[model samples]
Target: MSKTYTNSSTKFSFALRLIVVYLLQLFIKAFDYSFGGVFPLTFRGMIFTFTFVTYWLTIWYASEYIQKKISHLNTISIVTINVLIGIYCGLSSTVIYMLGDTYLFQNGDLWEEIPFYNPELSVALCIIYLLIFTVYAYVQKIFQLKEKEVNVEQLEKEMFKSQYIALKAQIEPHFLFNSLSVLSSIVHTDQNLASEFIIKLSKTLRYIIEQNKRVLVSLEEELKVVEDYFFLLKTRFGEAIQLQNDIDPNVIETIMIPPASIQVLVENAVKHNKLSQKKPLCITIALKENLIIVTNNYDKKEAEEISTGMGLSNINKRYQLIAGKNIIIEKNQDTFKVSLPALSTIDHENFNH
Candidate 1:
């Protein structure tokens, strides 16, 4: 409805401008009516209308020609072309009026008596028309540029949203498969722990299902989900994994992060390392300033299988589009760490719909 109103308003404004130009042309031609005292009103009105229409049509054609053929012309070139076109249009109108007076009015004497070959008047009118065209062209160009900028901005936003969605899709299934594997291993050995794991898994799944539909979630809600995820990891890994969380409750309440982000990083650490009685895997999750830091002790053993880097890569891409910042990864012989910015700082927002 707003769009329709805008279009209607634009059309109305254009019509109003054209009408004003026509009236101005009529007023200028009214100066030539002094020869015959109060010339027949009908004849005068016809002449005024005809001259206004001719001038308007010529100006319109000149504008169209400039837009189509010589749009690339520089300011000086445009000015020159505009002036030339204006002179041609004015001269043509005057000559047509003279011819009309001679043939239709049967007044050859009137054309001969009056000095109508004044190039100065034609040049002055041409300059005035040229200024009008220049202003109109400049305004039109500004509008076109603004429209193009708006379109580009909208496209960029859509692309970012699509990329974030794709990244989310990649992370969800990968994490779900890993969680199910852990659940399967625990179901037979420890039924009680397995039941708790099922509850945590359900909560995690529910959170993912609900939050994935949103562009952003509250920081407190995401952190609660992460804590639930941590519980499951603790139950599965037992003493082999040590978890430390040092998050600011204030920041947690207001700041948001991508859903399941913490789980992905923790899972990455566990999947790619050996955690046993000999080498304990200590995972630390902390929020410092605006960053969420996940660091784990690195211990590579011959027994554990290495993981493909897809999870971390997807997380990185998601952060890139959402936060406009790269996900920072730090690795050495002893430690592997990832630093994520808070969700409030990222592209997450309330869903438009």
Candidate 2:
């Protein structure tokens, strides 16, 4: 709300500045005609200064009055008001100048007498002034439209950032809980295995924290984090969790993705299913054409059905927004597969490592 007020104030300030500059130009023109005239220019300067200032003040007041009275006025109404304002200002300036001449300069035997006031000239001046005002209003309207477009783009970027941060926050707690459970199970049986798990977990967490600040990470960096995550999962499940990858080296160097996206999909597969010696969890990561595919064999035990479905939904939303592509899901009776479009980048070898 305070920001809105500030913006409105800034807009008002801009309008005020424009008006001041316009008035200054009119004053300068008046001085050029009066003070820079043929003979001694004092009396003419005084009359012209008074006429110019009075005209500017009257136009400003009339415009403000019309705008306030018809705050929701249409374009036609505004133009009508402007035309009327131009006529009134021009006529008022002429009348004031004529009155000044009659009252003060009646001893008209000066070196050269000013010309008599002409009503036809005043009418022509009003028409010209109104035309200029109309053009100025049209230009102002164009600028206002451009300003609105900029504001809209800024707001959308802000909204995307906010939603991205919220989604990241949701996944972190879910990830931490699962990883800590795995660590707890391994602590008592194999101390060295538990230590190794801790190291891998630390690396994964570090990656998440560091990459959360960025919107994208190289595919290679993301794959490294996924490999560390796979180690932790493999440590927990032993031979029950089988993982394979067939990623293209060429694609890896030129593609980027949101950090932890693959990890989330893999984690979802583990969380929603059962892993045992007889029914192992087989997960495969492969790149086919322009798609990165993650597939897992479905073998959920009756007792273990703890799927929330948020991870896949979140990843889908992020991918759609970032890449302008849909995350495709293919499901059969025996397997579930997710295919994400690989996001291209400018640097060919940026993700080589």
Maximum-TM-score candidate: 2
What digit string (tens of lDDT, one per residue) describes model 2 on residues 134-236? Answer: 6655665775676555544543453355445434643567666867888888799889988988888788767755654555677888888889989988876
lDDT of 1 by residue, 281-321 (tens): 88888888778899999876667545556667666655554
Count clashing pairs, candidate 1.
Answer: 1
Please give the clash total of every predicted structure, in order. Answer: 1, 0
Error of 1 at 323 (Å): 2.7
Q: List the residue pairs that clash in candidate 1.
A: 256-343
lDDT of each: 0.68, 0.68
Model 1 misplaced stretches (Cα beyond 4 Å): 1-194, 301-307, 345-347, 350-353
At residue 148, candidate 1 shows an lDDT of 46
Clashing pairs in 2: none
**Which residue runs of candidate 2 sit more than 4 Å off their true CA positions?**
1-192, 301-308, 347-353
**Alpha-carbon error at 83 in model 1, in Å?**
27
TM-scores for all predictions: 0.48, 0.49
